[model samples]
Target: MELGQASAINFGDAVAAPQSGRRAQEPAADATADPGVIETSIPFRLDDLRWSGFHTRVVLALGITWVLDGLEVTLAGALSGALKASPTLRFSNLDVGLANSAYLFGAVLGALGFGWLTDRIGRRKLFFITLALYLTATAATALSWNVASYALFRFLTGAGIGGEYTAINSTIQELVPARYRGWTDLLINGSFWLGAAIGAGSAIVLLDPAVAGPDLGWRIAYGTGACLGLIVLVMRMWIPESPRWLMVHGHPDEAHAIVAEIERSATGHDRAQRAGTLPKIRLRMRDHTPLSEVVHTLFVTYRERALVGLTLMIAQAFFYNAIFFTFALVLTDFYHIPSDHVGWYILPFAAGNFLGPLLLGRLFDTLGRRTMITFTYGVSGVLLALTGYLFSIGVLDARTQTIAWMVIFFFASPAASAAYLTVSENFPLEVRALAIAVFYAVGTGIGGVAGPALFGALLDSGSRVSVFAGYLFGALLMVIAAVVASRYAVAAERKSLESVARPLATME
Candidate 1:
C-alpha cells in the first residue's frame, strides 16, 4: 500500500495493537512495540482523529492556553455593549477592535521572538516563560482602570500566548508520527474554540447587563481567562521535552532516556530500567549553507511547497479573521441586539469553528495536502460568498443569517488548520521553527491584524452600498486565496513527515 492509501484508517483507527499480547503487559517492551501513540492513523480511514500519548498531558496543557485564547478574542465582541456602559472606561467600538489588534501585535512579536527561542533554547523552557507572561498579563487585563491600560495588558497577554502558536503546533508536529499528524493537529487546534465557546457561554450568563453590574461583568469575564491561564501553567509541569528535539540537538543520551521513559510508562515497567533509552545516533544541525541559500531554497527547493505554505496561510488568516470578527459586527449592528444577546447569535459560529477542524483534518494524511486544500478552500470560498450575499441582501432573517454563517464557519475551519499541519511537516526539524515563524508572522500576525482593521474601516463608511462592498472585498480575497492554492499547492498527502521534508528533487 502507498503511504496514505491503506485499509480503513481514521483518526481513531487500530494502529495500537500489541506486538503480541505478551508485549502489551511488559513496560520495557513498549519501545519495541507500536510507539505509534504520537499518531495512530495509517493508510486512510473515513473518520480521522488524533490521540496523544507522549504529550497527552502537554496537549491538555496547551488546550488550557487556548481556553485563554478563546476567552480574550470572544469576550471583547461578546461584551462590547457592557464595556461601553462603563463610566470609567468610555470605550468606543473602534477602540475595542483596536484593542483586539493590540493583542495581535503582541502575538506577532511573540510568534517571531519566541519561535527563535524555540530554536535557540528549546520547547520545554520557552513553554513556561511564554505561559507565565500571558497569565500575568491576562490577570492585569482584568484590572485595567482605563482603555489604555486594558490595551496594554491585552497586548502583553497576546505576546505571551503568541509563543503558543509555535510551541504547541511545532512541538506536537515533531512529537507525533506522520500518519496521524493531520487530524491530531486539527483536533488540538480546535480545542482553542472549545475554550472560546466556554468563554462565550460564560459572558452571556455572567456579564449580561441585566444581571452582573456594568463594569464588574467585563472585569469578571477577563479575570476568568486569567484563572484558566494559571491552571494550564500547572498542568505543563509534567510534559517532557521532545525526544526528536533532543536527538537533533546532539543530546542522543537524553533523547534515548525520554524515549525509554515513554516506553516504560506505556508497557508498564520500572522507572529504573527506563534509563539510557535513545538510539546511538547523534545529529548536529549546523550546515554551512548561506542565509540567502536557505531563503532561496525554501522556494527554489520546492515551488509547490512555497505555494502551499503561503496560499493556505493567506486563505486561513484572511477568511478566518474576516468571517469570525465581521460576524460580531453583524450581530451588534444588523440585529441591533444588546452585547449579551450577541452571545446567543455567536453559538452557531462558535459551533462551526469547533467542528470544521475536526471534520477536514484527516484528509492531510489520506487524500493528500493538495486535494484537501483545493477541495476545502474551494468549498469554503463558495460558502463564504453565499454567506455574504445572504447578509448583504435580505435573503435571510437575522436568525437565519446566524445559522448560515455557522454552517460555513464550521466547514471552513478544518481546511484552515491543514495549512499549519502541512507547513510544519514539510520542513526538516532543522528549519521547522523558522519556516513556521515566517509563515505565521506574515499570515496570522499581519493577515490577522489587517483583516479586522480593513473590514472595520469599510463598515464605518456611511453608505449601505459601502457595507455590502466590504463583504465583497472579503469574498474576493478568499477567492484569490483559493486560486493561489490551486495553482501552487503540493500533494504531500500520503508521504511521511520525514519524506515530505526531503523534496522530490532530492528523492529523484
Candidate 2:
C-alpha cells in the first residue's frame, strides 16, 4: 500500500489521507513535506488494529526484562544465607543489605543516564546495550571474590535492568492499543514475579547441600540470569522501533512503512485505504527535545501529574524493596527456617504477586485508572499494617507468616505495577522515557535505596517491634500515595497516547 501523494495542506491542518508516496531518502535537515511537517494517521491505525501473533512476539521479547530483574532480586534475597556461609567471602546481615542497596543505587544511576539517551537516541538501540550490560555484569557476579566485588557487579547488573525499565516501558506504551495498554503493561511488569518464582524454585535445588552446596549454588543462580539474557538478545531482533517515535523524529516515511507493515501482518492487508477516515495528528519533526523543554513539561506543564507519578513510584519502591530484599533474613533469623527452604515460602508469595495483576489488571482499563489504583494501594497498605502487627505480637509462625505475606502482596503487586503504568503513560511522548526514568530514579533513591539496609538493621536487633516500625512506615507511605492518587491521578483509561498527553512536537 502506498502513502497518498503529499498535499499542500497548511501547518496544523489534518491530512485525511495517508501522506503520499515514500521518499527515496529520508528528509533533509530542513525538509518539511518529506518528513518534517507531514500529518499522519499512524497512531490511530496502530491502536485500531487487532491483536495478533506480532503483538505476542513483542510482549514475549520485551516483557522478559522484568523476569530477569525478578530473578536477580529473588536470588539476592534467597541467597543471603549462602553468601554468609561462603568461605571466600562471608557476609554479615548488613553486608547482604548493602549489596542489595548497591544494586538499587546502580539502577538509579542507570535509569537517569540511559533514560536520557533513550529519548535522545531511539528505543531499539538501547535494548541491546542494556541487555549486554546485564548479561556481562550478572556473569561477573558469579566470579566475585569479596563483598566489594560482589556489590560492584550487582550494581552494574542493577544499572542494566534499570535502563531496561525506561526503554521497554516506553516502547510498550507506544506500541500497545489504548484499550489493552493498562492490562498489558501491568501484566508485563507483574511478570517480575514469574522470575521470582523461577529464582525461588532454582534456589530450592541449587542451594541444597547435596545438589550444589551453598557457594556453588548461589554462583550458579547468578549465571542462570546471564544465560537467559543471551536468549533475550536474540528474541529482540524481530521487534521494530516505535512508529509514534519515528513520526515525530523526522522519519514519517519510515513510520508509515512500519505501520503499513504492521497492518498487513496483523490484518493480512494494507489498511492505508481506510486511513483516510482516521484522525490525523500533525507534528513538527525535530532531532531531539531539549532538556529545558523536558524540565518545563514535567514541572510546569504537567506538575500535578508529576506529583502523582512520584508518589506512586516512591510508595511502591519502599514497600517492595524493604520487605523483599530482606525476606530470607527474617525467615532465617526470626523463625529458624532453613535457608534452602526459603524458596518454598517465596513460591507462594510470587504466585500471589503474579496473580493479582493477571486477575485485576483488566479493571484499570474497565473500572478506570484512578478508581482501581486507589483501591489496590489502600488494600495493600491496610493488609501490611495488620500483618506487621500480628508478627510483632509473636502470634505468627513461619508457615503462617508466609501465608500472611502472600495475601498482602496479592493486592500490592498490581499496585506496584500501576506506579510504572502511571508514570509512563501520563507524560508526553518526547519525554516519556526520561520521565519514567526520573520518577523511578528519584523514587528508588529515596524509598528503595535505604529500605533494605534499614530493615536489615532492624532484623539484626531481633526486636519484632523494630521490624514492625519499619513495616508501619512503608504502610504509611502506601496509604498516603493512595490518597494522593485518588485526588490527583489522571483518568487515562482506554485513551490514546496523544489524547492522554499530546506529543510535545505536535503542530497544533
Candidate 3:
C-alpha cells in the first residue's frame, strides 16, 4: 500500500467511450474558451459504484477519525475526576472547562486552516499531515505537568482532529456511492461512540488503584490515541486521491485511470460498453477556487442551505458539548459518584449513542434526510428537557440519571451526526471541505466552545437549578434547529453529489 494505490475503489465505468466506431470529440478550441475545459462522467461513475471490500477499507481507515475524537472527549470527561484529584495538577471545574474550551477553539482554527488547504491541495496529502499532528500532540499530552501544559497539548490534539473532520468527511462523501452514502456517513460519524466505549473501559482498568494509581492512569490513556493514530497512518497509504476532485482540477487522465482501476477490481473487467450511455459533465478546470468565490458561494448562492447547516450544527454542537464534556462533573458534584466508577455509567451511555445511528441510519436514506433529521433533533431536544426536569428535582439518582442520558442521546447522537452529513453533502465539490470547516468552526465556536465552560460554571455553583437552566437552553436550540431543518434541508438522499448541488466550474 502506497500513495496513489487503488485502496478505496469507487463505482461505475470509465470515461464515456465512442459509439458505432465514432470517436468522442474533444472540447472545441476557441480564442475565448477556457483551455482547461473537458467533459467527464466521473461523478456518475463514483455514485454508481457497488459496495466492495475496498469501500469497507476506506470506511475503516478514514472513519477512525471520529472514533479517535470520541475517545479524546470521553477520556476528558471520564478523567475529570482523576485530573481534579491529582497531586501534581489539581484542576478545578472551571479549569477543566477552560481546557475543554481551548481544545474546541483550536479545532475551530484547525478546521478553517486545514479545510482551506484540503480544498486547495488534494485530500490524500492532507490526511497524513493532520494525523501526524494528532499523533504528536496526543503523545505529548501524557507528559503534561500542569493544567496549562495539558491544555496546550489538548488544543494541538484538537487541531489535528478538526483537520481530520474536513479531509476525511470530504473523501468519504466523494468515494461512497449515493445509495449508501447517508447510512454510511451516519454510521461512520456515529462510530465515535465506539471510541467512547473503549475509553470508558480503559478508564475503568487504568484508574483502578490496584492496576495504576490516579496520576499514571490518565497519562497512559492519552498515550493510547497516539498508538492508534500510527496504525491509521499506515492504513491511509492505500487510499488514492478523489477522482471527481482530480477530474475537476485538470487531472482528467489521472481520474480516469483511478476509476478504471476501481472498475477492474469491482467487476474483473472494464465495462467500457456501458460508458456510452452514461451522462457527461463539462467543467472548466482550475487549480483552486478563490476565497472570495468560496465566501460568495456559501453565503449567497446557497444561502438557504447554509442557514440550515448552521442551525443544525450550532444546536447539536451545544447540545452535545455542554453535557458530555461536563458529564463526570455533574455525576460527581450532584450524585457523588466516585471517579473510578464513572466508566461503568459511561458504558451504557456509549452503547445508546452508538446504537442510535446503527439502528436509525437507514431511515435517513429511506424516509429521507429532512424527515429523519427533524425527528432525531426534535426527539433529542424533548427528551433532554424531560431528563433535565428530573435531575433538577433530585428524583433521579446516578443510576437513573445515566439511564435517562442513555435514552436521550439515542436520538441526539444521530442528530449530531446528521449535522456533519448535511454540511458536507449539500455544498459544491469545489467548496465541500471548506463548507464543512466553516460550519464546524462557527457552530463549535459559538455553541461548542461556550457550552462546556458555561456548564462547568453552572455545575461549580452546586445548584441543580443552574444546570437545569443550561440544559433547557440547549434543548431550545435543538428544537429551533429542528424547525429550520424541516423547512429548508436539501432532500439529497440517494442523489448524485453533482445533481444535489451543481459544481461551480460546470460549463453550460
The candidate that achieves the highest lDDT relative to the unseen native structure: 2
Ranking by lDDT: 2, 3, 1
Clash totals for all models, in order? 10, 2, 1
Model 2 whole-model lDDT (C-alpha atoms)? 0.90
Error of 2 at 454 (Å): 0.6
1 versus 2: better TM-score goes to? 2
* Candidate order, TM-score descending: 2, 3, 1
Tens-place lDDT per residue, model 1, 335-420, is 67777777777766788887877776786668776666677777777877777776666677778887887777676777777777
Write down the lDDT that model 3 would get. Answer: 0.89
- TM for every model, in the order presented, reads 0.83, 0.94, 0.94
Model 1 gets an lDDT of 0.65
What lDDT tens digits, residue by residue, belong to model 2 across residues 105-162?
Answer: 9999999999999998899999999999999999999999999999999999999999
Residue pairs clashing, model 3? 11-49
Tens digits of lDDT, candidate 3, 1-508: 1211221222222223222222234333312233466566677777777998778989999999999999999999999999999988899999999999999988999999999999999899999999999999999999999999999999999999999999999999999999999999999999999999989998999999999888999999999888988999999999989988887777777788898787777767886555545666767778899999999999999999999999999999999999999999988889899999999999999999999999999999999999999999999999999999999999999999999999999999999999999999999999999999999999999999999999999998999999999999999999999999999999999998988988898877
What 10-residue stretch in candidate 3 is worst by lDDT? 1-10
- Candidate lDDT values, in order: 0.65, 0.90, 0.89
